[model samples]
Target: MVQLYNNGAYLLNGTEIIEDNSEANAKLATKLGANVISKDEAATGTIAYGILEKHNTSGNMDKLKIKFDKLTSHDITFVGIIQTARASGLEKFPVPYVLTNCHNSLCAVGGTINEDDHMFGLTSAKKYGGIYVPPHQAVIHQYAREMLAGGGKMILGSDSHTRYGALGTMAMGEGGPELVKQLLSKTYDINMPKVVGVYLTGKPQKGVGPQDVALAIIGEVFANGYVNNKVMEFVGDGVANLSADFRIGIDVMTTETTCLSSIWKTDDTIKEFYEIHGRKEEYKELNPAHITYYDGMIYVDLSKIKPMIAMPFHPSNTYTIEELNANLMDILADCEKKALVSLGGAVDFKLRDKVRNGKLYVEQGIIAGCAGGGFENICEASDILNGASIGSDEFTLSVYPASTPIYMELVKNGCVAKLMGAGAIVKTAFCGPCFGAGDTPSHNAFSIRHSTRNFPNREGSKLQNGQISSVALMDARSIAATAANKGYLTAATDIDVEFTNPKYFFDQTIYENRVFDSKGVADSSVEIKFGPNIKDWPEMPGLTDNLLIKVVSEIHDPVTTTDELIPSGETSSYRSNPIGLAEFTLSRKDPEYVGKAKAVQAAEMARRENKSLQEALPEIDVIINKIKDNYSDVNNINTGIGSVIFAVKPGDGSAREQAASCQRVLGGWANIANEYATKRYRSNLINWGMLPFIIAKEELPFQNGDYLFIPEIKKAVEEKQSEMKAYVVGNSLKEFTLKLGELTDDERTIILKGCLINFYKG
Candidate 1:
């Protein structure tokens, strides 16, 4: 159903694809009748290029410095972003900033800390001239889609799923520091990324939903890095066939492909979407120029897509429902094997045990969050479960609308009644299910969710506590079908049900009554609320002339998600406090990482206080003596001591800065990895003054607890050196080279100055 182009391709009038092969350029010239089209000129024809050019503040197109029209964050992130901005001499929010309380709205954990953070957000919004959406009103991306998205405008958010490309707006999900830059009137610096063309054709089949198409694309592109760090520009005839909501479902999952951002060819469907949300003036016609060139192309035939499901452990472990059902035992065996690597054998995970009479059964089904909570998805799910019942067994179902307006419309159309009548509980708009803060399943339970991720511990399971569950990602339609089957795994296509396709009616009064919008007017006289758990960042030292770092953790997993670095769920309640949250760093993946990192941190603290490192950490004397034996210049005062982690691939999921910030607060100075999985994660490392180092060899040169001494490290970053030499300090010292990929000048400065906060402090 999906095909990837291995080479560059050209889109003719947004429909025909011409592969840039041996004679394609000559053929293009002949078709255009002697008109020479430069690649740069053709690039400007893409919708993404047009939007990016409008937001580019740098004079040169090659090196873009972007200033977004607006900014957004959720409660889990806004606190840290605001704290960083405030430390950097923030006068007022330069642009419209929306802080939504969706991640930690339950206030069920950490006593009153969650609600205290909400109050802090409200008062901060009032004092800084911003907007704040209260809990249950809308999730972060939903609020942005309903109110902030505009045609051809660019928006930056602190959530990974921040995508509004279907609305003809280019939105990116980055770490909080990027938003802090925009808040401080600084530009987001980067080299212009190549754009990939996603040419769609044919309408989807009856049972196939937008998540099916998205999963198919993600499975095809994720492993091969087809669209990694590139803009995905959707085009072609199929654009008109899908509704605005369908396009949104597919767009939000684009983060799984690791793409930078996305934009689409807008039509009346999008204009009607804006009209339905009472923002018709934001609509504008956006399409590819007559001829557009792309670095790559992904051609998708929507008609052939099947009811798909991403098996446990990752969103990319995809298989059609038919295939999975046909080969249940074999697939379950494979999943069980993979679970060992993901779960670290903490608990015995068996999907086969859930199978009864050759059919797999799930305990829970959820159609919630930004991916599944849209109006059409919920209406169709309600239709599927209209008269059917989710049996009174262990199986249960819950539905969450994307926003209060969607919930209101669902109630008005009687969908909520139908769902409740069928034993499904309808809940308010919340992101807990998607990020593991709510609806935690029982031990060893299997949950089918239409959420963003299915990573381990993302379903609120604590493997360290011998509690492990699994989540398989499926479309809302199929999830509803499964619920109707009373937890027996069933695809929507297996059932014969007609969709109601009820029309959506937005209730603006719901937002007007609950949301607090500053309307860009700041009141300096307002007193900012400060919660006890909300603490300022600790002081960080600048890069030293020489560095000594002990490898605290070594993870050989193919990819380590942010949840593994620092867990979600209850840990989110402590996100406002850096040190409080840092205690959980690598708690899930490496339980002893915190103690190891803190030991190194204590040494650095002693150095800053002009105390003996041996006095602080008695174990450090052995490594320091080993280093000084060979290199006479090495000393406690000259060498900065910290910890580092080596992973095969890290930073695969989420845009939370805590993954890196937590490590930085714990005295982590660098991360050595084979490669980084996402741009946002690497940016987090840079913004937090952590060296994102890459090793070429698959075999690691140093082991855990081995100290690596690098001389003249600060000078190397200042000199723009790509490669640096380091020596393992032990009985027999061994040297290895590490590479720092291309970094912008500002990024280099941020590292040299300690952090973004320190960069501005200077």
Candidate 2:
């Protein structure tokens, strides 16, 4: 259903695609009555380039220093972002900041710490002239869509699903430090990114929801890195066919394709969406110029898209419902094999056991979070399950409206009653299901969710506790169909049901009654609240002349997500405290990571205190002496001691800063990876003063506990040297080269200054 263009293409008047091949270029030049334009000039006509140009503060288009119109964060991230900004002499928010409490809204954990965070958010909003949305008020992105998004505006959010492109706004989900930069009135620095055209054509068949189209696109692009870090601009006839909500559903999931951000051609559908949300002025007609060019194109035929399912372990592991049902056993076996890789044999993960009499059965179905919680999805789900009962035998269903307004509308339209009558529970707006914070199923249970992700532990199973469950991502229609069938897997297309596509009525009063908006007014007299669990960041030392880092953990996993780096679930309660949350670093992936890192941290602490490294760790003297034999500058005073982790690919999933910050807090000085999965992850590492080193060779030069000594490491970063030499000092000194990818001057300085905090402090 999806076709990827390997070559550049031109959109002729936003109607036809002309590949940039020799013959096609000739025809296009003749049609335009002009010679072939420069790729840079052609790019200016694209919707993405237009939006980016509006936000770019730098005079040069090659190097963008972006200033977003607004910034957003949920509770899990806002506390840390604001805390970092405050430490860097932040007096007030320079731009509009919205802090939504949806991730950690469940106050059941940590005994009132969650609500305390909410209160802190409110007080910080008051003191800093920001906005705060209380618990159950709205999830981050939905609220942004309903209120914050506007045509051609750029918004930065801490949550990874921060995409509102369907509304003609270019929204990006980045690490909290990026937002911190925006709060400080600094620019988001990046090289000009490639823009990919997502050209959609034929209309979607009945019962195939937006999630199906999204999963199909994600499946095609994710593994191969087709759209990695590129802007995906949705264009073509199919854009006009889909409603605003459907377009949003597909747009939000573009984060799964590893794209930087997204925007789409807006029409009356989007104009109506703005009018419905009471922001008619925000609506603007946005489309590509007559001869816009894209670096690449992804042509999708919406008609051929089948009811889809992304099987357990990842959103990219996709299969159509028909294919999965036909080849059940084989697919189950393949999933089990993939589970072995993802789970590291921690628990016996079996989806085959869930299959009963050649039919797969799931324990629960959830249509929640930003992806599935939209009004149209929920209404269609309620329609599919109308007059049907979700049998009480080991099966349950739950629905969560994205915002209170959506919930109110559902209640008003009787969709909530239909869902409740069919034995489904409806909850308020919370992002717990998308992460691991809420709706944890029993051990070995399989849940089908219409959430954003299905990554390991994202379904709330603690592999450390030997409690493992699985989540398969599907559309809300199919999830509801499965629930109607009492959890036996069924696609919505198989069961013929008329959908009642009800109109969405925005209720601004719900937010007006609950949300705290500062209206751009800061009150310095207001006191900032600090809970007992909330703590400032630990002191970090700048890069030393010579550096020594122990390989504390070695992960061979092809990709490591942020959830595995620090985990989500109950550990989110400690996110406000750096050192407190660092205790859970690699808790699920490597249970001994904290202890091993702490041991190395002790040696670093000893070095900082002018104590002998030999006295702290006797083994360090042997390595130091061995390194001293080869190099004269390898001494405790000049060389700092820390730990590092080697992963094949790190920073795949969430934009959470703790992925790198947690490592930094636990005495990590560097990360060795073949490649980083996302830009946000590498930025997190740089912002936290960690060296993002890349080793080119397939064979590892060092093992866990081996010491790598890099002489003149500080000077290397300062000089913008791409290649640096490192020696593995143990039984024998083996030297290898590590490469640091292209870094901006500010990024290099951030590393030299220890971190963003230290950089600002100086």
Candidate 3:
């Protein structure tokens, strides 16, 4: 169970927690006599503050400009990131960059595009002095953990799960534009984030795994936004109880809590992790000051955490497996009701049909990707299934090691053989399963996985095609226990099994022989390879004095994921080509979105060509005529036409820039939402030169396909206006207010110039 602090708390010597109540100062005085410190002074004692102070270059703690020691990206993202940097006058990488091909490793989806991306990464590494890891070698984060991570260092990745706090490294996962800035020697600008303490106590039970603990924590904090946009600093007695791998498993899932980054109190266990990976010198002991203050605290009793499951469509919809079985019908009914909201009644989603003899059955079990692919998780899974067989009757199991070195060690230690003997198919290092690229299930089938997310359509089910499947997240041990039951949902604790905890031996020979490391030496003579499908970004128009944008798609879903915005799995191959990838925008969520956006884009195309906007789209005349009724100065010359989307909450998952860039390429000028789910998503919109508009939660003034015009839009942004007036195009132009929220000066310039690319071009 997790307990949340209602008020700020102080940690005394990293063990005792003193709540910041009325008598909190008295308590601190009782312990420290006259040595008590001010709240602002004590806040600097956190491990996060220490690491950030060393990396911050702004000379001001309130506003941060961070320069990371290294950078990382995967295949589906690296191609676009390098292309953007190349366009922005990149000669050689300023910092060490690693391009790993793990997302699109399989070339089966889009012909030669996958391999072409790999080749491009290799050549870019050679041309720009970067590192490239070939396909089937290692995933991005795992490789970073093995090689790139250094204690007390900062790393920025283009993946959301970029967390190395357990290794005493403060890492952040952000959009590709952030990486491009790092490649160009630009600082990552942000306000100093608040640090939250994850105060741990006691020890986990035998059957409890890291994922269970993580899910329990996520379930408690995600909805309430307790740690949102804050750095999670782990402290207290529980820090020494968990192993390094256990801490890592819990750390990587911190992204789900919407925290900016995380850092833990590092000890000998973390030092030994670096030693095992042949980087003992990279290890550094990190701890908080004797007395520290946290804006918020999450006190987790590890012993009380049971085996939990995150039900379909979200990582926060959690329930204990025992409770789920006891209340099967009610939970299944509740899931079906939530599915109606997530799926929009696109397909008939029913979990009741999966019940047989009062037990739920699943079609597949996957222990793959960064969350479950760790050495200890896989080894324990194999131990649980040592003598048990995963029967081959409408049920299958698959395992993927996070890196080739892990695979080699698993093979050497007989874990892979034991898994294979139990009818489990073990594969190489790939992030496909975690996304939607691999192990797509049949229609309406249920899958149990240990991957990062279980969002809708992330299991490769196309809602447009009337193919829908659901996934439930569990720990690797529980998934293996379910597989042993031949897909019957079973918790690992229900089965009496002794785990043969094996000590891992990391083999780095695979990476030494296969990976291409540029060693920070650039060659100007090298020619970068380009595939036919890979293309440069299209020209974008700057902000106009007056804006006319049509609401192309309106989504009322409580939260919209990036997967629904641009989709993954099949469309990942087209990410290198901006215009081509734009065609798939909102393809699954709204099939007519591309055509609607394209229709609105035609008027902008005509405006740029100095042609008649009325001829391009006949409806523009009516919208312009209605707008001219109130403001006679609004004309075609000063007005720009584009499309926008309104959602309740948008950009929930994924750090892929395509979520916003695809909209930009399709002539999207703005996004109207009640609130943004993540900071990375809002940053993507600003980086792509799109307006991130905020509207109230009341009834809408306009529906989809209605034109809303904003006068002096560019001037409003230049003036840093908090709210701008907009008129829905109707008989008299009804008025409404749209907020721009908070924008940095650089962000305002980026919006004025069009995008990051355009700002750099200017």
Model 1 lDDT tens row, 1-762: 999988888888777899889988888988786665887788888998888889999988899999999999999999999999999998899999999999998899999899999999999999999999999899999999999999999999999999999999999999999999999999998889999999999999887899999999999999999999999999989989999999999999999999999999999999999999899999999999988899999999998999999999999999999999999999999999998899888899989999999999999999999999999999999899999999999999999999999998999999999999999999999999988889999999999999999999899999889898899999999999999999999999889999978888887888888888889999988888988999999998889988999999999988999999989999999999999999999998999999999998999999889898898999898888888788888876778999999999899989999999999999999999999999999999999999999998567889998899998999999999999999988786799999999999999999998999999998
Residue 675, candidate 1: how far off, in angstroms? Answer: 0.7
Clashes of each: 0, 0, 0
Candidate 1 global CA lDDT score: 0.93
Cα lDDT of model 3 by residue, 677-724, tens digit: 999999999999999999999999999989999999999999999999
- RMSD per model, one decimal: 1.0, 0.9, 0.9
TM-scores of all candidate predictions against the true structure: 0.99, 0.99, 0.99
Q: Write the per-residue lDDT of candidate 2 for residues 1-762, one digit (tens) a residue.
A: 899987888998898898878687678768877556776688889999988888999988889999999999999999999999999999999989999988888797998788888888999999999999999989999999999999989999998899999999999998999999999999999998999999999898888899999999999999999999999999999888899989999999999998999999999999999999899999999999988889999999999999999998999999999999999999999999999999999999999998898899999999998899999999999999899999979898989999999999999999999999999999999999988889899999999999999999998999999999999999999999998899999999899899878888898998999888999899999998889999999999999998999999999998899899999988998899899999999999999999999999989999999897777888888888888888876676788999999999999889999999999999999999999999999999999999999999579988998999999999999889999999998777888999999999999999998999999998
The list of candidate 3 runs beyond 4 A from truth reads none
Candidate 2 minimal-lDDT segment of 10 residues:
32-41
Which pairs, if any, clash in model 2? none
Report the CA-based lDDT of candidate 3 relative to the real structure.
0.93
TM-score of model 2 vs. true structure: 0.99
